[model samples]
Target: MSSNSSIKCTVKKPVEVKISDTKSSLCSGLSIVDLSFPNNSEKGIQQIESISFKNAYTAFLTIKVKSEQNSSSTGGKWKMCLHRYQLMTSPHYESGSQDYFKIPSSQMLFVPQDVVSVRLILQQPSSAWNQFGIEQVSIETPTENTNEEEAISKWLQQHLNLNSTVKKKIENVEVDEVSGGLHRMWALTETVKAQQTSASLGRYEVDDSYEINLLSYT
Candidate 1:
């Protein structure tokens, strides 16, 4: 893939977020946030690249995903991608509160292909804060262009590896002495020009009047 290409999938706006039941007495407790993707035909099937969100006194987080199955008989099922992941170093304190975090591709248990929905189970044991929940949640998926570029890159790398001897021969070829001498001369001229200082006209007067009070010699 190209270095500049992003693997994150473009999440459509108006993401439906459903919050589960919370404790009435406590300010914050266990809660579930479900994110649904209604339209799959627009961008086609996509895999989960990463998950990102801003922390709002959330101590722990659990991630589950649902993906479309190939078989028509069997429908999509929910699978646990991440379980009881610690979001904050200390829930009681404000160490990880209001901090933005991104769960990288490597950390994910399994990359769910054709993912239709995602569930985030948040837990905040501490009641020190007035409100606690995850904020600004985002789901990233690999782009079609990224996948195509990755395939092309892999093919090119394989071909290059197979033709390593040709590359070595090109690198080993010596430069012509005439061209080398010209390059050296150009470099020398440039170096001399850089080192040369502006010549003084020996005149320190502005309007035929000397402005210096003391003579300076170095």
Candidate 2:
């Protein structure tokens, strides 16, 4: 995962739209082409879906918002999306919401595509002049193969560092070979004593005795 880029933003008002990156609008707005305006009352009326690239395996965006103080509408939800599939939904905001939050590919079980594009959909948003700003959009490229097993193994190793720095003597004990469950078990050895004797009191009145021994096991 490498390569990152930010998408250009187009700001819109109730009347028209344009391909401009200047922060002329204070807070909120919708995405649209020039001369096209979306219904402000409608939820998610604007969608930025044209940030296309090659070999993008993961994508994320930065959002900036101005919290509502005494406004009629509370801050609304927005989506970090791939096509129409959303990878994340922003939490409701009442005050200013500005941060660089990451939207990873794993959220939507996203697989790398040769031609990949990400879209940000704003739903029930307040005016762009007052509410939110789309900051930075980025996508990551897959340099290596990715799989569920490999991802899970990597996550477990990162969080559970049982054998990270130092090697343990009792490791990878196959507790259940049939089920393929692994654990750590002690490698123990012990010794035991055993004796055997025999005596006869008949005939020649002779007695014989023998000693037996047992060895360590497991």
lDDT of each: 0.70, 0.33
| Candidate 2 per-residue C-alpha lDDT over 1-218 given as tens digits, one digit per residue, 9 for 90 to 100 | 33343333334332222335666533333342111113322222132212322211112222222112212253432222234332224223332244344544554433223221223444223332333333444433334446677899898776557665433433554457624432222212112222333644443222343223211221
lDDT of 2: 0.33
- What is the per-residue lDDT of model 1 for residues 1-218, given as tens digits with 9 covering 90 to 100? 42222333333332223344664432337777777664563343477677788998889988887766632335655788898889889989988888999896669787677766677888888767656778777766665455776789889778878999976876676779667998999999999999988965446655556656523532
Give the range where candidate 1 is weakest over 10 consecutive residues by summed lDDT. 2-11
Top of the candidates by TM-score: 1
**Which portions of model 2 show Cα errors greater than 4 Å?**
1-29, 32-96, 109-112, 127-131, 145-218
User: Which residues of candidate 1, in runs, are more than 4 Å off?
Assistant: 2-28, 41-45, 70-76, 144-218
Residue 183, model 2: lDDT of: 24
TM-score of each: 0.53, 0.27
Instruction: Kindly state the number of residue pairs that clash in model 2.
Output: 6
